[model samples]
Target: MSMRVPGGGFDSTNPIRLDFPQSLAVYDDYAAAQKAVDFLSDNVFPVEQLVIVGTDLKRIERITGRLTTGRVALGGVLSGAWLGLLIGLVLSLFTTAEQSSLAIIVGTLLFGAVFGMIFALVGYAMTRGQRDFSSVTSVVATKYEVLVEHKVAAQARELLAGLPGGLPDPFA
Candidate 1:
């Protein structure tokens, strides 16, 4: 006769954490994570069952889309300033008897620089301090985990075991 156990034989000591359930395979590079996903897919794993969670939200966003609005605005302001300077120079060249005056050139350059700075600052501030403004570095976290759907968790584990890396279980 089989002995009766409570909660369908699930040990209280093994209470599953719904937030982060399985294992983590930390790769030094994102390419590795992508390669792992590709390999799993090639082996008949459906894409829907796998999720690539970027540890860095900004990096993921950038990869999935074109330049952010701040970058775009900054670029536009810079380009517009340069164009304006060129137009001003041309106007001065035609209007002045000899050459563009130093005053005009300096004034235009100063105005352009100030405008560019203001636009950049405003664009950056619009992000509400969610991103870094001083640098263009593709910010990413040290670790990113590939979450598997609960239904295909066992298959994922099996496929991972067949791969080169061993998945390490992480805890809070």
Candidate 2:
């Protein structure tokens, strides 16, 4: 999303684009790109005129472990325990002194664990052997490019040049 500034150029609500952006440099990783901006800030350059863009996106799924009935049941029990504890605390707060809050909490905790285990086992059984593993998925960029507004591109480049080993690499 972009909006027209007072000048002929435009500004973006996205906070990442510039008016006629010029590539200040390309980096192999996000940290490097961040470092470039940090360097500019240290030098008192107009840091707000810059943005870092990730390119060449790819999806990655890292397998954590194989799932089993025991692990699933244990996970469910732990989750339910937390929920039951919360409920029991609130219910105990309204009870008379004759009613032992400890007993009420323990009762609810046991019931929750039993129910959670049963539900987790039944759900796992329905899944069958189709999806038996656990994994984490994420989308990441292979490259990061730093951009600067056209009006300040030259100043940004000059400041970046002063950074140790930060000159824009033509071949990069």
Best by lDDT: 2
Tens-digit lDDT track for model 2 on 30-106? 98899999999999877777888999999999999999989989988987787788888888898998999998888
The number of residue pairs in model 1 that clash at the backbone is 0
lDDT of 1 by residue, 41-109 (tens): 888875444555556444533333344566656675786578668766766675565654666766676
Model 1 Cα displacement at 110 (Å)? 12
Tell me the lDDT of model 2 at 39.
Answer: 97
Q: What TM-score, computed on C-alpha atoms, does each candidate reach?
A: 0.43, 0.84
Backbone Cα, N, C clashes tallied per candidate: 0, 0
